[model samples]
Target chain A: MSTASSTVLRGRVWKFGDWVSGDDGIVRFSELRNFADDHDPAELARHCFAGLVPNFAERVTPGDIVVAGRGFGIPSHPPAPMALRAAGIAAAVVESTDTAFIRRSLNAGLPVVTCPGITDAANEGDVLEVDLAAGRVTVNGTVFAVKPFAPAMLEVVDSGGLVPYLARYLAGNARA
Target chain B: MRQTVAQKIIARAAGTETVEVGDYVTVTPDYTVMQDIYFYKNIKILEKLGVHEIAYPDKVIAVLDHTPQAAHGSIYVDRNRESREFARRTGFDNFFDVGRAGLRHLIMVEQGFARPGLLVFSDEPNISSIGAVGALNVPISTEVIVSMVRDSNWVRVPASVRFELVGSLPPGVWVRDLVQAICHDYGGGDGLIQRCVEFGGPALSTLSLDSRQGLLAGMYHAGADTALADVDDVALAYVQERADGRPYEVFTADADAEYDEVRTWDLSALEPFVTAPPKHADVVPVSDVSGRRITQATIGSCASNRLDDLRAAAEVLRDHPVAPGVTMYITPGSPAVYSQAAREGLIELFTERGATVLSPGCTTCWGYLGALGDGDVTISTNQEHYPGRAGSRKADIYLSSPYVVAASAVAGEITDPRPLLAREGKPHVHS
Candidate 1:
């Protein structure tokens, strides 16, 4: 992993009002799919953002991060996270996530970070300079109190998720 | 100092010293799984850092079960695009997309991803129930999971909050409502975080896996790390199928596990509970809130959208028209639940009785579906009733159990479920 002491992740901050329980809301940016259309909640969820504007995917700079208040995805739609992963954002830090979101994100090798009180600081378009070791965020040179990421979580963030982290480990094992 | 189940389990998993209350243990993660949405975003971060290859991709399962599809807005559209791009760029071989998949817990158990005897860390609450199948699994701190993927160990900390569930739950009352009630009764605060929650008493046996999942959601919402239920054959068999080469490990609290706080209640005395406004789970008795002229009533969501809950609601609404002027909406949890409800004619009963049935999903529960105009009052069986759950920020919401919600529909206001019990030929008891 590239060892940069600090990097300023710049992007618009999107806040999720609910929790990430299952696969719901993963495709909030798709063609405006409604759960009632197919009479299958899961099916309609896959068609999310079928016609919505400013899909989450299109709102990112390379280093942008997503933010949320609590309970991001409680509906448990499996493909919800995939849409976000597909969009190529840098990282996600939530006030809380459902276990489904955590499991699916990790299994899919996604990086999800959580701290109890992250919503207190950091606005939607504020440029953030994150110091990994110190676990603090700097906005306009002012450091705000952010929960320090767990070592494993930081690894996931550094490796971009579980798959890449595992791939590297597996390859190293083979090489050794 | 006594040890709780959480302490004992973490102690055994670490295989070192026996731990007492107030102790902590850092452990190696036996298994780690990621929800695909964040995984994709994390992948992009990794790519930027010029890092390739994961530490243990095989041990790690990449799940793409979140963000089912993007919505009509450009922002959501971009979210999906980024997710898809992350999946493609990461080269995840085990990605399970929409349509051909089940839930995270079901798919992991079905695909043999989680096993018994290992300490597993997950990001979700009910998803942690997959460990309930068998194993000394405990949902870890999210920040910890994100940070310590490389570390194989953690400090085994003891918990002070002890929540005891008693008696048996009535039909139609899922664990989510109970959880909300618990949070409502006892404020959900930092005090419960990192605590060990042991759910037991006869009430647990009556809970189905769906109910168990809901209860676990409560524990997670309370911010506790581990929740253990008594194991049975069904759990054993489920674990055996996915255990690969791992031996089964059971973590039970020694008769002497310490509990900083303990509270118990009889579920039999638990009536159709309801939380009035401002919050989904901040509960008030149905009797207290009845006659509030509920403009809307809805059923179906992760918290209350189970078959049993629907069956219970249908029995109440079968031939009765939703009290005049009350707009009723029913959205089944999933296709499977919908088909079962339909087979039983529950869907037909609700629709025939003037209740508008939205297809199975999070309709109206989220701000996206079953919308109401400003100043509308709604009664729903959902996890939370925080502002914006259904639309207008000025809307007044009353959250209740399915039975209570159905009863409220017939009463045209929030009414006690006790009258319904008598109407349905059952005895009435209140806690």
Candidate 2:
């Protein structure tokens, strides 16, 4: 676990209704299997929100954010978060999400801030700034507290993902 | 420090003597059972993680239920192909593909992949569907499969909620009815979120293994993270009967275990409860919606559909035929249950009465197969009734016990099942 300076993420927000499932909402489950063997992350990225949002792949821009209701990115699918990162999204701030959704986002090296009432403060297309380490979010010119990443989880994300985290762990073990 | 059964199980898996509520422990699960729906991404993720050898090949249990018997050009086939190859390369010992089993949750317990007090991860929130045998199962994310292969994952010991069920289940009253009552008492789907619900009380011992499974499987309806049933002689004998001579251990909660909340109810107070659609706790008596037009009737799934369930359905359909226009699908929960149902002539009775026997799988209930047409009203013996859960958002699904499903199928609408089950000389005790 490392305690580094708090990182601030700035982006335009996109909102989804409650429980927009990880499989159907973030990306179609079929798209996951169709391009699975291709080993192409961009292929997954292009089809992100394929069924839920029309022209998602064409319209989505870098550093755009998603503000979802409870149970965001649920159903235990890994490719959902990876597709988010590959699409160049900055972060996702949710009212609540499943542990797996958060962990998958961490594995994808994506930041997810769980905050109550933050969704109400900002409308869709609102510009927001999320400070990771500080547990603060600025939307509608208002600041509110949000859940911060655990020191260890933050370190894992800093290393660029679980694969690099494991590599770092193995290297450290070898040195020790 | 009064520890609960949920805590004890986590303690053992975390390699600690004891643990308190909210303590996050790094745990290596005894068995990780993955269905085909979520395993495709896991395999690809493992490849990217540079996993040469699976960390616990012997501990992995992969079942092909969600996509069992893949059709031509189906996405399910793609998932099945990649997942099978990944299991082969990773050297996982137990991969139950199509024709072997339907639901991994039930198949895992039947094949001894899960037993008392062994940490189990089934990936979906419905993992507790196997808690009947005293196994603590977590419905986790796909990343968990990756962690189980590469290293381990952290588990925070959840505070246990005690459910004390007492009294006897009268005719037509099943665990499905009792579960709805529990959900209503605990706050519907919003209640057990993130909490560990522990079932107890005298009547628990009398509930059949299938009934216990139904009770456990109902945890997802209330949004429970996981669940545990106190191991009794009934659960023990059932485990031995299905364990294939494998060693199984039990963990008991301390006599004075602390509970965040305790709710008690008598089974005699329950009747044939039913859920209309969408939310599980959105329930009322079957008589409330009697004669509501139904186009489809299904009597099978991972949760409620079992041998006893099939028998209950057959009992109603034995003497009478299905409604003139309404069609019914009878799916056994597993190959073993399917065989038993066939041996008991339940399959014969169903087809003779205009019911179609489906292959054993989550098929229609999950909307992967047996999808209903638009605006079709269905009465099913399955758990989910959520919008678009049964493939079509326009179709309405009613969740009920097999007894109710059977009777309702005959009438082509929601009907009280009391008359169908009150017949004399009933030798069978439907779970």
Candidate 3:
């Protein structure tokens, strides 16, 4: 478990509409069946958003960020966010999302920021900068404030998700 | 400070006197449940974290409810076998394997694990059904591994929204309709996100335990963090009969407790409603799509597969055969429900009327049984009708009450259940 923190991410934006289903729009449920036992990041990345956006896997470059309207990741399964991270999505900024989805994304090592007016602030193909520590996003010279992760949650993401965080905790405790 | 039922429950679990909303606190849940579908994944995550010992074996339960019969394939069979072995190795005597298991939500309630004021950690949010008895369900999704390994989880105490339901539901209109009505009204915006919904008001006392469970189970579709209902005699009696000597505390909200919002709903004014295909927020009255043809019908899910729901379906299908070319499937929520339905001849009535009786598990609801073919249209009591949820992406699923699903099965179309119930003299009163 690598404890690498990319607090600041710069990427092109992939804007989506409201209520983009995490299962169908982010990653098709059928595609998840292929990697049920072994969730290979590269293999899962190949099918990200294959249903909604044709050749999305081929067109998308690493370090791209996903921006969407309200209720993003509704009816999301756990694997949906993992698929996004595996597909090299640096962060997700949305108008709003369920708390469960937010937690799931952070656990998958993807920072999900909830900004009230993100959909209207950013557009497709525009470059955006996300700062996790500062809790802000910059697009087109405009900055949008986002709800920052709690200090504990930031530590979890900094450690590359909860598993590694726990691993480090156990190791530190053992030394003591 | 006065605290709502949810706040009080969380405070109890945290071993604190009071916990305000938004306060992040570490809590030791009363119980933690694992189901078949995610059991392997959870174990894999635990292994990755290098944890071996069971933190609290007695407080842990493992059940093979999703694919109990291995309907999907040998993968489920392999997982179930591995789950059995894990249970034995961990000394988790609370494990419920196939034939002994049903939906984990209903199992938690029927076996008296979900007593009033207790906190439970589960994988799926719909396990909020246990809240019918005032128990709080905290769904951590795949993060349930955190609780399993550490025997504790961190939670941000959520604000509460109270639904004051008044008056009794009219004939042919069920709790499922009432839930859909709530979703239709408050599901669109972020009003319910990260908030706990509390069901109260005069109508709550009139509702049976099954009806209350159905209502709370569907609260997740409305984007609630979790839901709980006011516990009354109806809930307490049901728990008393099945509690198996478990000690429980009954907590009620203080009159001066704070809430994010409180809305009143008149049950008698509600009409039969259906969530149109694809979007749960696109709920409409049954009359909007009454005559649409349906190729399949199902009356089973964690939300609406209790005895009253079965009886409602049986009442509609009695003395009538399922329409030709229409396949109907009925699944009981738990083994206890199945046995009671069988004793009451509800199962026989359904089978005789050409409706298939599946095992007591999440069968059709989870897309394990009665999977739809391409272009098939189904009226179901399942929780979700999202695209590709049931089977082929080309197929469509409309969500409705058991009464509507059963009547639609009889007519091979989405038919309002009131007309059919009127023709049968009167609607049967649900217990």
Candidate 4:
């Protein structure tokens, strides 16, 4: 795996959010994440989501730092990024995580981080290490403060984000 | 580097000049999307153009869904007369008559009007709603229809608001809510004036077809046109179906499609969002401003008010009553939706909640129905929240999802729905 420089988020790293999985056990592509004048949301939807989500449940492994931007959890349909987190496809979801994704990740017990300016530093495959407590990112071990992520957010990340933490006690349980 | 499908399509359509950012190219529209008013006018325009029989009338569609009824009998008659006359004169055999369809964008997909790789355009803001098809793709117009029809290609320009979304979002929160939040984050009504807005990121796939449509609709600012990805097969069906010969080629950039700016959004961490009035694109978290009182609130328009939208609102209004001073109106996108809602008990629920259900048509949000009196504060699901959208230029309008609107109707203010729904520790996934 190639490491990037922390001075400026200069590496290729794939991002995974809580809003990515689908009902048919497939990976769904996000339109907002991609911007193109000729892009067809429907075609992308069918290509990525019609039958499956990224299949990250099986495709992703540990040590992967998923880079995220803001307002991530905006999908109305369920079974997205939640299932991926539950399956342990992502090691740490970092960057501007939205409220819904945060809530769902915490419930699923996924590890997530929120570090601003991280996207600019990372590319599609660059491995990144982000230290939330120090508000620093170490790409290939070089460090920079860049921007600070909320400390309160770390607690949620530590709790596995949302699903795994909550699912253990509530599987098949009736509404209280 | 591999060329994207859009790039390939553009290359195919563009014979000489390669399509690029900021390049003024006429994108031939494979299919034309029309709403109620323009369909009538276009028939007259066609007569003036002196084309007795349409060259590709099969590729064109006429959807009547604007004003179904007027307060005054004469006005109603006049509007209907124009609508019927246009349908008859244009030889438009493919007409989605009122009461049989929902919004034009939604119906276009349900009826398979949109197909993948098909370049499509319309003369309105709501054409962006077709982005939900997941396979059928095309260019949508933000300007007048006549210009696009004369020359199929819309000018390819860079976006002013480049939102890079990276996280997961809540289920109830949708594209409409996020767009409203963006509009709110900007200046509400004037932020996107003449500016292109591009929404991108890994989180976009998480949105449903309907939600994507809502986002496309929300991108309409006075300054720029609207567009979205129709990169794959499901999208192809929608585009190909509308193509004049074969699917209009997709126009995309080579890995490096140029963009003026980029903003990222993490869906996971986003709260159920909202955008308060006088601005259609302004956006805010539902948690930040729910329960704020209002005078009038409405749901339904060319851009919003689908069956799912209505169902969500119904879910919230199930047992609640409208706030004492608030008067809520729920207008189905078309007569079919109206009938379906009635059959499904959504209409009854809306009525029980003290909501007034209007005849299926474009009302409050389209600057029709004299929807508001002076000083009326309205919350709607329409795409843009400009002044005079609701009859009164001074009226304040808040844009939100059906859930937020319904919740606010009961609380009598801009309040979030999380607390009322009492959703327990569901996983909050952010990118």
Candidate 5:
């Protein structure tokens, strides 16, 4: 199977600590009411990392990478992830994860690389080169291995997301 | 690759021979229900994706149980209007409005939408409640809500974590106790992360059908993808009573089916347990924290709102009035459950004992319908206890079983329920 070696990427890193739970870490449950009626994705993106770093939105540049400690997205809500995608987050790098969190991330069209020690791989504002096909990351002149996406998963992601994948699928099926 | 029960169900739904762990499959759901919170959000997403029509309206069930009907706020009023409007627009057939159903998961089974060997989906993540009926229930993410609106959703097959039950519970020990023990043993829930946790072995025969639902409740936030039990006589009868002649399939794991790992639990040795504040995994023995003062007590959720749970609470409140300065709320899981309890005089008994018996709905647990003031301490029958989950981060919430909740409400403090059970000459039990 084709692995991370063929999938190369570059982005500046925005870092955080361990156990950034899906609930408060991504966004507070109380704040969900703000976006409950009609949500603006960019507005949500502005509140990114508000629970940890209040000034995070001001610092976040498009196409930046998010590196965080173990068990990122543990509460398993999707708003923060949706915010990341809307904010043009290139990918997510976390130490480890429960598979449900992985599913949640991918379903939201946010690529996540589960490489242990990812937290120590780079500091905030450092540009890191990630090779998804090779399961490797180069940060500050040092390189390390990260888990790669499966061929099937890469296909879904490359197609943009599950919605787009299904659009192509239903279209082709209708043609057939 | 070896298949788990969850994989088997998903493969069957997709019309495939087999699927391994991490293999993605798209299956049309047998049923899909959304809580009131997601009702408008799903419609909005579907519209954003340029889908003007729902593909399977009959397959969708609309549940308006969260955020009380006639609640005194704009959030509640707007959501209730959107819920009705969505059902009207999509022509969804299985709409469970406030008076009809109390919890989305219970209504799916009681109304016979989820049965043996079916694939069920809901937008609500706490859907471990649906797994009790010998079916696979996936509480999907928002992205899949688009797929569901378009008639399909992708799912990765989950590996199985088998939990074998042995022996029977002693007096005053309950199924919630066993669930708490599993959480504690797994280091507050790491062993079964993202895996299907299957309950089997001889001890199941000793439990009632509703108790099986309790077994799935604790597994939700602990990160078990799904919790299941084989279709025993109890499960079979429960389904038969509610299935209404709908076609259903019953399945068990193949003899050669592989598990990630299997652990056996002796329920006989288990004791009543109460979870500490702010997290489900911070559990302690009830005796360890006896007499801690409580300001509020709430019983009845998808976890423990059946007739059996009501009877247990009634038994506790029998001849014992609720403690002054401690407010208690008892909400049934469904109109059927509340109607049955009312027919049996349980509602009057609760009211007579100074317990505020609310009809079927979710309140005080989800933090929307009713909220506690700051510095308040509450003991509830809810499983999830993230900070601010109950409307106030300043308040402390302790998760316990319904029996313990009732006893504690009466005492105005967290007290072990064994003494109450012994006085009634009954053993510790669950629905």
Candidate 6:
């Protein structure tokens, strides 16, 4: 297992369909109800995709990617992406997703790329390579272009999420 | 370059002349709004970042809207208390305590914090409701903690999709129906994904600020990043009355502004619509599934629950009792809305008809109050009907207008409100 700060990632794909809700699909709203102030990633990870794919938490290995169809992660609940990261998912390649989902995913230390046809191009258990910097995905000898994250946002993902990025930012400002 | 309304607003906030789509710029929001549900979580994140002070205390606003009365239990009670202490510690005068609380989206506009051409960052997408007054609210989810600490955050300019609303809505065809129809048409695929939606054209003159807010708030169902309405006298008048000497700017789209897509919708052509359970965009006309029995009904949420919505519900519940075995909950959006509904006799009519009048907050819409039992079918004016949103996953929640919710409660089934409206004479459209 490797951190997401690496520019390129190789993972087995886990496929999902369109409109998989962040609340109900990725992580159930019920799982989020009882957290004591701070949401423990390990606890949330145990329930990640438990609603959609039973035993997903146990089966998913670190650096495995999530590929989905359009409108993935609707109603972008903040903890859904965090739960995915905690459950060892490295990156998400989707046909489309809302802006909030993109921001939340990056802030949770998970990188998401929007590729127009990634869902149909890849299958479950297929080994895929994602080039985060180049905004390209390769599967089965086929390549697809994806919308790349902006440099500033990429820096946040590279620093292992927004909290760490802001820590460094505030420290840099103080030093200056 | 001809810029869209959103571009102009962002440009002003970013201190730039203009911004093109896909351009990332750091901008200071006019207001950074927080709700109780995520307030403590944000503070925890801020502590992790080692930021002790809020960068812009004057621009920060916190509201105890989601669990104002701590409807759930002790956790919410504790969170609410801590939120108050944090606000006081930070010297934030904009905190709306329990009694003054409402849905943050509505309170921001009602209190004049969300004004034309100002940018707001919030935790939920429905905060786009501020667009009704020509303000843009970007939903940053948990990242609002970043904005609170820095007073600014980076935003990627999104392409705009323009919906030119034409013609007036027919009687009994509420703004919710029109919004659902638009969602049904444009929600599929990537038509509106991550895009800014702007509403304009001939019908803008007739739609009230409440209607416009209702319409904009539902754009999230269509996958819009955020939404805005063209500024007009109707919007300006409402803002001027509430702004209370606060300065604001009004931005309009250039005549030749570029849009990713231009769509025209005739409001009169819309019928009473319903977004069925499990999907916000799975919209169908009310007649398609009219006779399904309903055990619970509610008329509240950030999407609806304004004065006009309450009045609409009252018109349907007038002289009628909720059917046996049916429980209906009515939540006004804010204290002001509650007081006005009381003055207008809407609350009295609702209570006399056997419906529960909850405090002015998120209420059942948030799955906090009036949680449904297993196998309970519900008709509600709230947005989002994902499984288990209102308690039981076995329960089926249907989303519609206040009129439909009231009528369905009265009949104990999914019933159209047009017949009831006809029986009661012409329906009143409150602004």
Tell me how far candidate 5 lies from the true structure as C-alpha RMSD in angstroms.
3.7
- Model 4: reference contacts kept, as a fraction: 0.00
- The DockQ scores of all candidates, in the order shown, are 0.07, 0.24, 0.49, 0.01, 0.33, 0.63
**On a 0 to 1 TM-score scale, where does candidate 2 land against the true structure?**
0.84
Docking class of 4: incorrect
Off by over 4 Å in 2: A1-101, A104-148, A159-176, B48-53, B75-91, B185-189, B241-248, B423-428
> Each model's TM-score?
0.63, 0.84, 0.95, 0.60, 0.89, 0.96
Write the residue-wise lDDT of candidate 4 on B149-209 in tens digits: 3443333432234566676666556556566556555432233433445555666666555
Q: Write the per-residue lDDT of candidate 4 for residues A58-146, one digit (tens) a residue.
A: 44443444565533333211234444443433434354432223333433344345555555656657666655556567665555463
Lowest lDDT 10-mer window, candidate 3 chain B? Answer: B66-75
Who is ahead in DockQ, 2 or 5?
5
Candidate 1: regions farther than 4 A off: A1-176, B1-3, B8-26, B30-37, B51-66, B77-94, B101-118, B125-164, B170-177, B188-191, B221-226, B237-248, B279-281, B321-365, B371-373, B426-431
- Least accurate 10 contiguous residues by lDDT in model 5 chain B: B141-150
Q: TM-score of chain A for candidate 3? A: 0.88
Q: For model 6 chain A, where is the 10-residue window of minimal lDDT?
A: A30-39
Supply candidate 1's per-residue lDDT for B126.
49
DockQ, candidate 2, comes to 0.24
Score candidate 3 by DockQ: 0.49
> Residue pairs in steric clash, candidate 5?
A3-A133, A4-A132, A4-A133, A4-A134, A5-A133, A5-A134, A6-A133, A22-A75, B172-B428, B211-B431
Cα-based lDDT at residue A5, candidate 2: 40
Q: Where does candidate 5 chain A have its weakest 10-residue lDDT segment? A: A167-176
- Model 1 TM-score is 0.63
Ranking by lDDT: 6, 3, 2, 5, 1, 4
Q: lDDT (CA) for every model shown?
A: 0.56, 0.75, 0.84, 0.52, 0.74, 0.85
Candidate 4 TM-score restricted to chain A: 0.49
Off by over 4 Å in 4: A1-176, B1-10, B15-17, B45-53, B74-76, B134-164, B184-202, B222-224, B230-253, B280-291, B334-344, B423-431
Highest lDDT model number: 6
Q: Give the TM-score, chain B only, in order for the candidates.
A: 0.78, 0.95, 0.97, 0.79, 0.95, 0.97
Which lDDT tens digits does candidate 6 get at residues B1-431?
78999999999999999998878789888898878777777776677766656778888887887777774545778777877888789787788997888888889998989899999988778889999999998888777777677777888888999999998888888999988987887777679887889999999879888888988998988788899998899889989999999999998899999999998999889889988877766899999989999999999998788888888888888878999999999999999999999998888889899999999877897588898778999999988788788788888999999888988999999999899889889655756
